[model samples]
Target: MDRRKFIRNTAATSSLLTLGGLSLNSCDSPRNKHITILHTNDVHSHVDAFPNDHADFPGLGGLARRAGLVHSIRQENPNTLLFDAGDIFQGTPYFNFYGGELEFKLMSMLNYDATTIGNHDFDNGIDGLLAQMPYAKFNFLSANYDFSNTVLDGLTKPYKIYEKDGIKVGVYGLGIQLDGLVTKQLYKETVFINPFEVAIDMETKLKEVEKCDLVICLSHLGYEYNLEQKPDDLKLAKKTKHTDLIIGGHTHTFLDKPTVVTNGAGRDILVNQVGCFGVNLGRIDFYFNNETTVADGYTIKV
Candidate 1:
C-alpha cells in the first residue's frame, strides 16, 4: 500500500484500517509486528466528567471512562503503551485540595508509561512537585530541563527505551521554556537548554547508537506557534530526523487526526495532540514487517 494514501485514508475516517490488506488482528503473525500507542494530554486534574448541562464537554471525560477505554484497548492488543504529554497538574479544585497527589495516583492507576513536564506543573513549586513523586508509578522524562541544582536532579530521566515483540522503541522528552510561564521561585535553579539542539542529539543517539526501531518525543512544547523563532512541535518535527512521532501538549489543540509532517530526512513524522480535560484519547498503530513499516492514527472521544 502507498504510505501517503494510507495516512490520508486513516486521517479521513475513524474506521479500522488494514495493514497491507490484512486486518490488525491478523498482523499478529511472527513475521509481522503490531504496536499500539495510546496517549492523552493536558488533563489538568479532571477526575470527574463535566456536568450534563455544561456547554462544552457535557457528560464527557472522566477518569473512570478514560480508564475503561484504555483497559479495553489493552485487552485487544497486548503490545500497547500509554503516554501523556504533561499538564497533569492545575485546572480544577482537585489540585488545590490535594496538591497533585490525586492526579499522580490516578494516572499511575491508568498505567501511563511516561510523560514530560509542563509549565503549569510548577504551580505547586519544584519541591511540592517532588513531594508527590512517591505516589507516581511512572517516570518523568525531560531532556532539556537541567535539574542538577534542584531536587528533581535524579528523579527525571532524559530518555527511556522499551522493547515489545522484538521492536525496540526509544522515547525522549522536551519541555517548553519555563522562564516566563512559571515563576522563578517555583522552578528555582532549573536550567533550560535549547530544545532543538537537544532533540538532534537525542534522536541521533537513539537512532544511530541505541538502534531503536521507533523514536518518539513526548513533548509539552505545544503544537504550533505563530512566531518562527519559538519552538513548537511542528518546528521540532521539521527540524529533526529519526523521530517517528511527537505526542504534544500545552496548547490544548484538538486534532482529530495526526498531522503528518515530512522530517528533515524527508520521512513522515506524526504529530498529534488530543484536546485538554481528558475529553479525547489519541491512538496510533504501527505495523512492521521485514520490508516495510506502516502507521495509522486517530483520536477517540472519551
Candidate 2:
C-alpha cells in the first residue's frame, strides 16, 4: 500500500490514532450514528517502540503508533473519546529515566480525554504524580480516592461529562485499596474510600443531575477478584445502577470482548479491559437510538 493509504489504514486500527473524530467505514449512513470509546490501562511508560526481536511484543506498541490510530479513528467518526485506565508510570526505561514526564507529555500530545490512578502510579510517591501533573492536559478522575490531606488534593475530580454529537457521557473513576499494595509514605495522606459508595454517588449524580446518556467508570479495582471478596469490575457493575460501562485496569486482563452484566435495575453494564502497555487498544463502539440505548466493545491488537 502507498504511504498515505498505509497511514490511513494504520489509524483505522489504533485507538489513539484517527483522522479527525472518526475512523474509516465508521459511519454507514448519515442517520446511522456511532460513537467510539478508545482506552488503555497499565501502560507503564513504554514511551519508545519495543525492540525488534522482543520475546512477546516486537515493534508493535508505542505512543506514536497509538497516536496515529487515534487520529485515523477521529477522521472516520465524528464522536470519539480516548482515555487511559491508569498505571501510567513505571515498566519501561522512560519512567525509570524521566520519572513519568514523558508519559504525561505523550498522553497530552495524543489528546487523551481523561485517566484514572493505579497502584503503580504511586511508585514514585504522591510527589512524583504531583510533579508530572503540570504536563498532563487531561483530567484525572478518581471518585474512590480521597486526596484530602495529600498533595493530590483538588488535583482530581470525582467524575466528568462529555457530549459528542449530542450523546451525553458521564465518566468517573474507582481506585483500589492501597493499604497493602502501596507504601504509606508513598501515598501519604491519601485516604481510600469505599468504592461502592463512590459508585453510587457518582452514578446518581450522572444519571439524575447531569442527565447523561451513558455513564462510564474508569476502574483500577481489577477485572474480577476471587468472587465476592475483592472489589473488581464485575462487583462494581452489579452494584451500579446508572453506570452503563466500566473500563477497567490493575489486573492486566486481556479481554477480547466486553463482558455484559446486569445492574440493580437489570440494565446491561458493559465492562472491558485490554491487557497492558500499548500492545492492545480497547475500542467500544456505541450505537444509540432515541428509542433504546446500546453499546459494544472489543480489543484491537496493535
Candidate 3:
C-alpha cells in the first residue's frame, strides 16, 4: 500500500474543455472525488542536497524535500500515486559508494508506487539492480526491456493496475534503447525491444483486458529529439493509442506545465517531465466521469 500519507487543504479549480462542442470535464456535475499523480524522473542518485557553493544548483534537490512534497500531496488527496522514471543509479558518490542500496532504501521510505529501469541503472550490471530489489517495497515495471537471460528475468512486471475510488489507473514503463548509452558488458543479455510496439501491447491489455479507466505510461524516453528522430515522448504520444498520459525522464527536462498532444485516435494526450535530481516534484490532477472529459489539469512544485 502507499505509505506516504499526509493531510492538507485542497482547492478546486475547474475548467470546461470543449471537444467538438462536447464537454469532457463535466459528464455529471463537479464531483468531490479526485486522484492526484505525483512523479519524478532522472533522479540520478542525488540523495543529498547540492553543495552551498555549487554553480548551477545549490542546496536544491534532496530526498527530504521530495518526501515532504509527496507527503503533502497524499495528504491533500488520499488517492494519490507516486512514481519514478528510471536512472535511479549512477550519479553521485552515493551510488558509487553504496552501490544503489541507498537509492532503493530511500525510495522505499518514500512509498513510491512503481518505477522503471534506465540505462544508467545498469551501470553496475543487471545483477546490481536485482541485488537491491529486495530493499524496495514497490515494483519495478519494465515492458520493453527483455530480461529473459539476465538475472532480472521474471522479477518485474509489464504493468500494474490500481483501483482507487472507482478509478482504474493503469501504469506501465518503457525504457530507452541502451546501445550507445550503456556498456554492452554492463547490460549483457538484456535485450531492448521496440517501445512503440510494446506500448501498443501494454495499452491493449490495460484498456481492453484490465479495463482501466486511465492508462499512464512511465517513460524514460526523453521528451523530444533532433528533427527526424522519433525516440522521444512527443513522438510516442503521436504514434501510440490508448495512452492517456506520458510521464517522462532521461533528458533532465523541467516542464513548468504539461504539454498536450493528440493520440492515434485524435484524442488529447498529455506529456510531462520534471527535471532530474528530485529538484521538482511533478503533480497532475485528473478529474473525470463515466465518459470522456479530462482537461489540462494542474501542476505543482515540490
Candidate 4:
C-alpha cells in the first residue's frame, strides 16, 4: 500500500495500524537488511491519554497506546530498536507522585534501547536522578554533559554500539546547556561541554574507530535555533561528519518528515523530532545493501 494511504487507513481506526503481512522480503537476489527505529521525545510522564475534551491532541498519546504501536511494529520486524530523546520526567501527575520512577519503569517495560538526558531530567537534582537510575533498564548516553565530578559519573555512557542483524549502529547523545534551563542546584557539578567539539569527537570515534555502519545522535538540543551561536540539530547536521541520523528534542517541534541536510563532508544526514508529550512516535527505517544504504522516516500519531 502507498505510505500516505496506509497512514490514512490506520488513522481511521482506534487501534491505529492493521498492517498484516507487511513484507520485509523482496525479490532481489541479495536480501536487504531492515532496521526499524521507533522513537519518542519529551514524553514528560504522560502515562495516560489526554481528556477527550481537551483542546489539542484529545484522545491521543498515552504510554499504553505508544506501547501497543511499538509492540506491533516489533512483532513485524524483530530488529526494531526503541529510543527516547529525553525530558522523560516532570510533566504529568505521575511524575509528581512517583518522582520519575514510573516513567523509567514503563520505558523499561517497553524495552527502550537507549535515551539521552534532558535538562528536565534534573528537576529532582543529581542525587535524585541517581536514586531513580536503578529503575531504568536502558543505557543513558550523553556526550556533551561531563558527569565526572557528579554523582552520575559512571552511570551514563558517551556512546553505545549495537549490532542488529549484522548492521552495526553507533549511537551517542547530546544535551542542551543547563545554565538557564535547569537550576544550578539541580544539576550541581555537571560540566556542560561544547556540543560541536563533542559531536566531532563522537562521530570520528564511532565511524573511524568503531567502524559502525550507521551513527545516530540522540540530541536534546532542540531542532533548530534562529540565533547563530545556539547549537541545534540543523547546525549539528551541517557541521558534523560521519553522523547518519539525529533524533532530537527540547523544542517540541513537530516534523512530519525528517529533514535532510548536507553535512561538512557533503553527505546527506537526517534530523528528526516529534512533538512533545508523547503525542507522536518517530519511525525511521534503514535498508542496507552491499553497495549503498538508504533511509525513510515518518511520524505516527500516538
Candidate 5:
C-alpha cells in the first residue's frame, strides 16, 4: 500500500491547523525545514492489543502495532522524534512479571528519544525503577522532581536539546505532585518542586541560554482538575511564555487534536494527550523557517 493508505488504515482521525499566522502551503517551500514529533502517554505496560470482543477499545492498542506505525512514519520523515509522557509501568501482567524491563526494551527498539517519570512508574519503588534504567536507551527528563537525595539523583536530567535538520529543539519534563497519590516510601527523597516555577526557569534557559528554536514540555501532570489549587497542563500552558507545546498524561484524557492555548506572551501553545494503553499516537508536524514556525497536529489510532 502507499504511504497515504498505510496512514489512513492505521490512523483513526486527523486535524490541521496553522500556527504563527502561516499558511499550510508554506511547508512546501524548499527553504522551510520540517520536523515530526510522535508521542504517547500513559501506556501503562499494555504490550498487547485488547481482544476483539473486549469492551471500549476492542482489537486496538498493542506495542507491536504501534511500532509498525512508528516505523512507517519514520520512513516518511527522517527528522522525526518519538516521546512518551510517562506512566510507562504498572497496568498489565507484563509490568507485574518483568517489573518494567520489557517496556523499556521495547520502547528502545522503537527509538524513543525521551520520556518523563510518572507516579505509577514508582510502583515498584525508586530502586526498582533505577534497576530498569539500563534497559532504556532514551533519557529520562524531569525538571521539577528533584532526585538530589535519592538513588535517581544523577540518572535523570532537567532537560535535553536535540538538533533536527539544523533546528534546535529543547525538551524538558514536568511531573505531577506525588504527595497524596503516591506513598512516601516509593518516592523517598524525591522532592516535588512546583511545576509552574520549574517551567519558568526551564523555558527561560532553553530559549535564551540554549537558543533553541522549538521548546516542548513532556508533562505527566493531568490535563485539568476541578480544584483551583491543582496545577495541570492547561495551567502550565497559560503560565509560561516560551514553551511551544505541552504533551501531557496522567489523566488519560483523549483528544483528537491539539488544544491551542494563548501563552503569557500572547503566542499559541499546543497541548495534546492521547488516552492511555497505547491506544493512540499523538503527532505534530512543525515547519520552521528563519522567521517563523507553523504546526499541524493530530492523533492516530494504534
Candidate 6:
C-alpha cells in the first residue's frame, strides 16, 4: 500500500488500499464488473458545514458537499449504491424545527439506496420517524426490529436484493436494543430481536437460498465495545458466515480502513465505519470476475 494514495480532504480525493491482498489492477478482466458502495453513518441532521471557527472540525461536513461528492462518483460509475447505517436525525436545529423532513428530503436527493434505524432515530418517537418516511424515496431495512404491532408495520423490509451488472447483492439491517437506551414511549411496542440470530438467518437465506454474489449487513450495532458482553460489529463478523461486508454505525467510530474478521467458516469479512456528522464518506469497490470478488476501500473527508 502506498501512503501517498491515502485519502485527503480535497474534492473527490480518493485513496485505495487492497483488502485481503487482492489487487484490482492486476486482476482486471473482460468478465469483471465493478460495484461501488458509498456509505455514511450518524449524520445527525448536519445539513450545513461546521463554522470555520470551530476548534476540532472547523469548516468541515455538510449535506450539500456530500451530495456533490456522491453525484460526482455516480457520474463516474453507474453501478454505485449509496447507503446509511443510522442516526440521520437529531444533533442540530434542523431536526428540531423540521422533524427530519429536510434530512430525509436531502438524502432522497442524494439517491440513497437504503438505511437502518438507530436508537436516536426514535428520539421524537416512532411517529416522528414515520412522519418523515414519506419524504424519503429510499427504503429502511430493519431485520432484527419487529414492527408487527407498531405503526411502522409493513413500512420497512427485513432485507432487499439488488442486481448490479448481472451480479446479485443481498443486504439486510440490524438495530441495537432500546430497553435502556430509548424511552418506552418513543419506541413503543418495537420488539428487539437478537442481531446474531438474525444474522445467521439472513446470511443463510442470502447466500444459500437467494444465491447472491455479495451479502452485506447494514448495521447500527456500533463498531466495537470495550466490554465483551456488548455485541458489536466485530462480534457479529466473527459469529456469522457468508456475510461479505458490514457497514456499521453508532459509537461514532472513525475507522481509517476496513477491519477484516475471520468468520465461523474461516472466511474473511470486512467491517467499516466513517465517524459521524457526515464528516467522511466510506467507499468500497468490489470487482468481480467469474465467481471471485475483490474489495478496495477508503474514507473521504467531506
Q: Score each candidate by Cα lDDT.
A: 0.86, 0.81, 0.79, 0.85, 0.87, 0.86
lDDT of 2 by residue, 1-302 (tens): 11111011212344232221211112211333567999999988887677889988887788888898889988999699998999998898789888999899989999999999999999999999999999999999999898998889999999999989876788999899999999999999898999998899999998788777668899999998786777889988888887877999999998887777767755556788999888888888777542222355678777
Q: Write model 4 residue lDDT over 1-302, tens digit each, in one string.
A: 12311110112222222222111111122436888888999998999988898899888899999999999999999988999999999998889899899999999999999999999999989898899989999999999999999899999999999988877788999999999998999999999999989999998998888878778999999998999999999999999878888999999999897877768875567789999999899998877664334467889998
Best by lDDT: 5
Cα lDDT tens digits for candidate 6, 1-302: 21112111111232233344421112222456889999999999999999999897899999889989999999988999999999999999999999999999999999999999999999999999999899999989999999999999999999999988877779999999999999999999999999999999998898888888778999999999888888899999999887878999998999877877778866666889999999899998886664345677888988
Candidate 3 residue runs with Cα over 4 Å from true position: 1-32, 227-229, 290-292, 295-299
The TM-score between candidate 2 and the true structure equals 0.88
Candidate ordering by lDDT (highest first): 5, 1, 6, 4, 2, 3
TM-score, candidate number 4: 0.90
Give candidate 4's error at residue 235 in angstroms.
0.3
Judged by lDDT relative to the true structure, which candidate is superior, 3 or 5? Answer: 5
Models 1 onward score TM values of 0.91, 0.88, 0.88, 0.90, 0.90, 0.91
Winner on lDDT between 1 and 2 is 1
Clashing residue pairs found in predicted model 3: 6-75, 24-293
Q: In candidate 1, list every pair of residues with a backbone clash.
A: none
Poorly placed runs, candidate 1 (over 4 Å): 1-30
User: Looking at model 6, how many pairs of residues clash?
Assistant: 0
- Residues 1-302, model 1: lDDT tens digits: 11232321222233244332212111222447788999999999999999999999989999999999999999999889999999999999999999999999999998989989999989999999999999999989999999999999899999999888887888999999999899999999999999999999998898888888788999999999999899999999999888888999999999988887767865567889998999999998897774445677888988
> Which regions in candidate 4 have their CA more than 4 angstroms from the true location?
1-31
lDDT by residue for model 5 over 137-251, one digit each (tens)?
A: 9999999999999999899999999988877889999999999999999999999999999999999999888888778999999999999899999989999888988999999
- List per-candidate RMSD values in Å: 5.8, 8.6, 6.2, 8.1, 6.5, 6.4
Candidates 5 and 6 compared: the better one by lDDT is 5
**Model 4: colliding residue pairs:** none
lDDT, candidate 3, equals 0.79
Clashes of 1: 0
